[model samples]
Target: MGFEQLAALKDQLAKQAEEKRMAKRAQHAKPAQNAKPAKQAEAPKQAKPGRAAPTAARHAQAQKAPAQKSKPVDPVVLSIGKLQKRFPKAFPKNPAPKVPLKVGIFKDLLEHSEELGLNEAALRDAIKVWCWGSRYWACVAENAMRVDLNGQDAGQVLPAEAARARGLQAKRQKTKNAAAQGGAAQQAGADQQGSAVQQDAVVSQDGSAAQQDGTAQEERAVQQDVAAQQNSTAEQDVVAQHDDGASQQDTPAQQGNVA
Candidate 1:
């Protein structure tokens, strides 16, 4: 019901998403079983157009994800859905902008938790998730009116709370930008590597008969280097994003945000 449990729930949801993405990617990938084509494996076969497969798979996954997500309503999300129905003014349905919730709203929900058939943990997670979204953050601005359970005005959003939301939103944007830059760098590297491989293959085909074997080995080494670089960069980006998220989800900050 506190930050500890809330953070755990947040992490579990994130982990599930990442796992699904990886699984989808893995399914879309087709590894070549017929290897060691020594005769024509020269110059690394100029690198197959395998990158497009993953890209296409990701696009497909994005299209299908929402439909799939709607089917699996966990207890926490189910509770939140019920809350949305029970208190439409406080928790408006989608397409209506979310409002800033009254400060200390968690305590308010606790009073109804038993009657609503929700436990402390589920209630906490549900509310945390509701507040954690960017839509909710956008609503937590200066002078914003906080809504009570009955959809009545409770209080005004404090400068401190608005500042906190802005800071969290800034961090979220920064992390996203960093990851996007990393992806861009990786793509550029892959393109460069592919171009080099293609040029080398052409040179080999242009009567460099004796150097074909050496050329193949060199291409393999270059591919390995590129792959290692990509992996290291991606891991660093993920860690940075994770740390940024953990900091935002801490006790004090999340309390103000959730409130």
Candidate 2:
């Protein structure tokens, strides 16, 4: 309970409190350092090789390409001078040929004048006076046929006569064919007769030639027999002469021995 003892206890308690506070601070600092190192390792894991950022460069290049379009063609133009130079005869419209009475709107004017209820003889006289051709007459005939004539008959009326003429022509053609057939038949008969005559003449000539050949062979055989008989007689005469010469030589030898 003295003052020295109390002061010593207070000093010991103060030193112990200071030592506990320093130990707590060192433990908290060690944990903070380890957390910093763990954070660094996680950063390296997140940023791996396969992880890359996306860019818009390819999309921008596609957008910048130009759009394609088809090209157009131009038309050709010719000058009037060129057209005129190419077609000189066609300039200022081509000149039309004169419409003759036979070809144009003026043919057959006379025959149909009665159908048209006009003075046909007088019209004929007028056409002759005007020196019109047959084409004008034809045109007038066609126009007259087209006219309304209150049921008047206007076609040609000679059909029976035309049919009679055709019948006569057919008859003439039939007669000509009959005559041609008769002539051909006669010619064939004459050719057959001529061939028969030629064949008979050839047979007669061949028979005469065979007879002549047989006679020639018989004559040659007779000549050979006569020549063989003459050769046998000559050979017999030669043998007789040789025998007479041998007898005369024997008589001469006997006479010499008697002398």
Candidate 3:
């Protein structure tokens, strides 16, 4: 009976295992339902050809824009105002400093010795230094003297004029030097020309002397020829006279014999 019960229990376990395998097979083999496909929507249409394109009105704003303008200033008038403001005591009515105002000279003084107080000697030294230590002190000193004599700021009236004068003097000197060089070259050319003419004259004189010598030799030869001809003619005349005399003497002898 125990063997029969054990065999029955084994058979029951095998049946339960077979049922679970079948359930798993059924779950895997079931087909999924077919899903409905989503409907495709149509794309929107473009604008028609007859319709006008939209544009902004911003371009009209550019026409009404303001233009930039500059104000003009006169340099001389501005300089006068600036001078009056800076030096009210001296330049009361826009008077500049009473110094010889060479630009390079003043610049040097301002750079090296600002405390020199714009005196004539200091200005002259500055000018001399600026001119590469040239002895043009007299020029600046003369300007200073002129300013002292007139009792006014020399720079106000004479700065620009002196600058112009210096430029003009430099130009004149350059022109004078050029003219002198040209004259020297011309003189040298003229001397060469004169030498050449003298050489030609000497050559002509020598040629004339040689020609005269030849002419004199020819004249002597002609005189010798004439003398020879004259001597021959005289000898012939003497022989004829002798022959005539001999003939006359023979005729007289023959007559005496015939008688």
Candidate 4:
């Protein structure tokens, strides 16, 4: 083959190879553009209009959570605090009396001491034996205080009656008092009536005696009149008898003279 003919063939092969490489590069660039649009679409989906960012929302929720509470204080510590507040002078540092104090004082302390991990009886024993009647641990006998051994008040434990019962009792007492007063009044009235009756009886007796005396005086006056009448009649009869005797004597003297 001729040398010119070989050179023209080599040139044509080189042009075809260059054209194939340019076409491949254009195809790869189209795919890259499409990929960019797809990435933009995914970005809008991740960030919706009304939704918050995942990290930001999680951070906000964490901030809104409540904080954990601290541990509670011990009962002993609370009791000690209560005692200190109630009696600052007694428990300047801590309430530790040495001498045998009143049970009243111990009862007051016992109300708080139970929470200090010691009951009433246990605290009393501790104060008596552990403190040995020291001034720092005030201890007393069960019967040594103003209050009772049962931790009750020294004053009345139970009322005489409930409100309603007391009201009823008071009403009954009032009624009883009224009845007594009424009985006394009735007795006094009866006594007065008896005295009045006795006075009337005495007056009636006096009137009867006066009437009897008047009747006796009238009878005596009538008897005196009758006796005077009888005496006058007898005198008249004696005079008449004397006159008759004188007449008889005169008649005899006249007859003798006639003869």
Residue range 1-259, candidate 3, lDDT tens digits: 6999999999999999999999988777664334566788978775667653343234444556666677786444454344335434422341223333323323333443344334444444333332221122214332443222123443432454445435434544554555555455455545555554555555556678766665565555556555545655554555455556534543432222111
Prediction RMSDs, each to the true structure: 38.5, 47.8, 43.2, 49.1
Q: Which stretches of candidate 3 lie over 4 Å from their true place?
A: 1-149, 154-164, 205-259
Assess the local accuracy of residue 240 in candidate 4 as a C-alpha lDDT between 0 and 100: 48
Q: lDDT, candidate 3, residue 51?
A: 53
Q: Which candidate do you rate higher for lDDT, 2 or 4?
A: 4
| Clash pairs for candidate 1 | none
Where model 1 places Cα greater than 4 Å from the true spot, the runs are: 1-71, 205-245, 248-251, 257-259
Give the winner by lDDT: 3 or 4: 4
Q: What lDDT tens digits, residue by residue, belong to model 4 across residues 65-112?
A: 888899997555555455445544433343544222322455555766
Report the candidate with higher TM-score, 1 versus 3.
1
Per-residue lDDT of 1-259 in model 2, one digit per residue for the tens? 9999999999999999999999999999997888744444444434445644334556666689877776652211122122223323221112422111222112343344455444544443333322222222222322233211122233331344234324434444454555555455455545555554555555556677755664564455445444544544443344344445433543332222111
Query: What overall lDDT goes with each candidate model?
Result: 0.78, 0.41, 0.45, 0.47
lDDT measured at residue 72 in model 4 versus the true structure, 0 to 100: 94
Q: What's the candidate order when arranged by decreasing TM-score?
A: 1, 3, 4, 2
